[model samples]
Target: MCLLAFQLQKHPKYKLIMMANRDEAYNRPTTPADFWSDYPDILAGRDLEQMGTWLGINKQGKIAALTNHRDFSLPETGGQSRGHIVSSYLQSNETPEDFLEQLHNSKNEYSGFNVLVGSSEELYYYSNIEQKTEHLKNGTHGLSNAFMNTPWPKTEAVKKLLCDYAESTNEIDVDVLFNMMQRAERFPSEQLPDTGVGGELESMLSSIFIASKEYGTRCTTVLLVDSEDQVYFEERTFKNGVFATAQKFSFTIENPTA
Candidate 1:
């Protein structure tokens, strides 16, 4: 998930609310949000290339999402895919804080990325790039390719929407969040990081929404876990060569202990 905005609370009707965008090139192979056959309780869009996911939720009320770290100086070491970190966390039995602590000590196992994990009791964030992991205090937060709460254009856009959505006392629903995500705009190409690998040049040559591309949002995703522990996940894909598409899925805590 490239951009994520959320409201987390302890309320009974809606304990956790999340909206995010999973930006990637159009050609990346992925299975849209659905229940995995091997893990029926796991609901998320799978990255077919690696048995991983940008975001997912399990029937036990666990939630996880990951964002690639934006850095030009790091070497490509063919480390574990960041999506696997999210999927592994969602499939674990650890609490948010415990899971983050474990992840902090095991960062060397995976590529640099930012991860978000949560349950009904807590929410935590981990960034391998920064080598830090901690719980998020009660408040709204936004995260993109950079650090959490960094004011990038997409982050700010989603943050503003989240704040606006939170003010209205009306019952929040998944569709409302999906509409907001769909309407999100991409950042200008010039703002993209210059990887010095002719990324800027390639961006100019092709319209693919590559992270290395000049400026564009490859995907947008939103996740909401209501007070009832009902988790909702949605994503929109943008490809330079084809029409865009959107997908959404929802799952509630079954038995709250699954």
Candidate 2:
């Protein structure tokens, strides 16, 4: 997940609302989002190359998502698959705090990455690059390659859009969220971050929906949990930023025993 925007605990009729786009190489092999056969409770797309996932949820009402943090100094083969960090949380019964506290010791083994885990009711953010973890407040937030809500042009733009979505209605308009992902507006060169990558490359990656011949936006996903505790997950996959397919899954979050 290169770009992520979400509104939590701020909507009248929803517990959480989120929209994200995963950017990857056009040639990389990936499976569309689905309930894993081995871990049938887990729902997410598989990174075939690593047998992990960038984002996922389980029947236990657990949610987890991961985004790579750009760091040129790190070797391509960092200790572990960052995707596995997300997949691991989905399969475990640990609370986000406990899970991350354990990972703190070994986080250095992984490549630069930021991770979010816990149910919508109690989300937590941690980045190995920043070496910090904190409970996300109830409000709109964004994440990209740098850090949580670093005000990157794309992050700031979509955060406002997501904020509107959260405040707009009793339920989110999936279409509105989907269309926002199609934004291709490139940030001006001067406004882009210089994270070691050259200005030319940064500009190309500035858009919410990227379109490069070798690499681009791979999928757009919208996830929501309503006031009644219904969960909806949708994904639209693409090839070079062109829509290729879409998938949807729905469930209800079981209430805790009194």
Clashing pairs in 2: none
Which portions of model 2 miss their true places by more than 4 Å?
73-77, 255-258
Which is the leading candidate under lDDT?
A: 2
Tens digit of per-residue lDDT, candidate 1, span 1-258: 666787777333577777776666656777777789988888888888888998878888777888887665786544777788888887778777777788878788776788988765577888887888778887778887778997666567777877787766557766677666655234576665454446645344222123444334556566666766676667666665233787777677876742
- The digit string of per-residue lDDT tens for model 2 on 1-258 reads 899898888888878888899999989899999999989989899999989998887766788899999867656545778888999888887778889998887887888889998887879999887788989998999998989989899999999988876676776789999999889989898888888788789899999889998999999999988777789999999987789999999998665210
What lDDT score goes with residue 240 in model 1? 54
Q: Could you tell me the C-alpha RMSD of candidate 1 in Å?
A: 4.2
| Model 1 regions lying over 4 Å from their true place | 10-12, 173-175, 183-219, 234-250
lDDT of each: 0.70, 0.87
